[model samples]
Target: MQDYLKPTEIIDWQHPQVLSLARDLAGDRADSTAIAKICFEWVRDEIRHSCDYRLNPVTCRASDVLEFRTGYCFAKSHLLAALLRANGIPAGFCYQRLSINDDGAPYSLHGFNAVYLPEWGWYRVDARGNKLGVNAKFVPPEECLAYQPRLPGECDFPEIFPEPLAVVIEALQAHQTWDGLLKNLPDRVSVLNS
Candidate 1:
């Protein structure tokens, strides 16, 4: 995907934080899959998920997830992607439409990331709101397509992030690549780091 291959606007591949952490992660030594696993676990436990829209962008980088961080799922995924990309791993953002009931309606939708694992193709990970696997209203790890979003600001569910998920999803459906997904994202994705 040329989109994924192009440099990113949000992730600072040159920051000392990025360089130091990537170096420490065992470049070229550890298998890319293992490194991807390590990065996934780091994101899983590190960032606190929230829908806050303003925070320092520099710190908002995924590296901050380890230092001091809070963000919704997309923000969290950005950080995870940055961390992996640091160590020369190719990572991409994934989106899905999930139908939910309870936020004053019969249904709604949300998005999360599916990181590209060279050996694993793409592995889904949700790093926001709460851990899954219990009391999930519907089947999770859902395909990005095949569902619907209810309304704007329907922030009733404890999900990985908040809306405008339609922007990214539509882009993915069209471009079938990372840059495609990013084309629809805000100039700067928001975050909360308190």
Candidate 2:
């Protein structure tokens, strides 16, 4: 739980801008759930999905995502987690393996957040930035993620990580552009077991 709330190099909740924004989002809300929902919606609606918009720089860290106003799904999750953690709520990362083409093969990891609400314990939310055919909401006890794992090799990973996976960070850092990141997205979850 402490790990979930702690700022890291990637999560970076302690960063000045992130901290200020977190306070702004919370904005007189005393309930953890309300704060979480506000933070979740802010990231989902305010931040642009890098690949979806074809934006550049391939941000990984939370602060970078907020600064750029655009990021891939993984980077967006980082910002959401940071905002939640900054507001004194625990948040963790979750992933799903899905076919990039929605058919088969070329499966890549999709990242999102699982926040610990006092009433619901742990709840997952996807801040991947909604578009036509993709809607992710912060309704506790009932998840409405951007995509479902329906394809042959797709799966919803059970573990909730305190920080973004190393592979995800690596991919974001390695790729300089949104298109590059899209082409070389990380696919393996075996590292989680290792």
Q: Which candidate wins on TM-score?
A: 2
Instruction: Return the TM-score for candidate 2, rounded to 2 decimals.
Output: 0.98
Stretches off by above 4 angstroms in model 2 are none
* Model 2 weakest lDDT span, ten residues long: 185-194
lDDT of 1 by residue, 75-185 (tens): 566666677667766666644333233254332234444555565665555444344432111112342222234454333222232222434334323443333333333
- Candidate 1's displacement at residue 191, Å, is 21
Report the C-alpha displacement of residue 1, candidate 1, in angstroms: 4.0
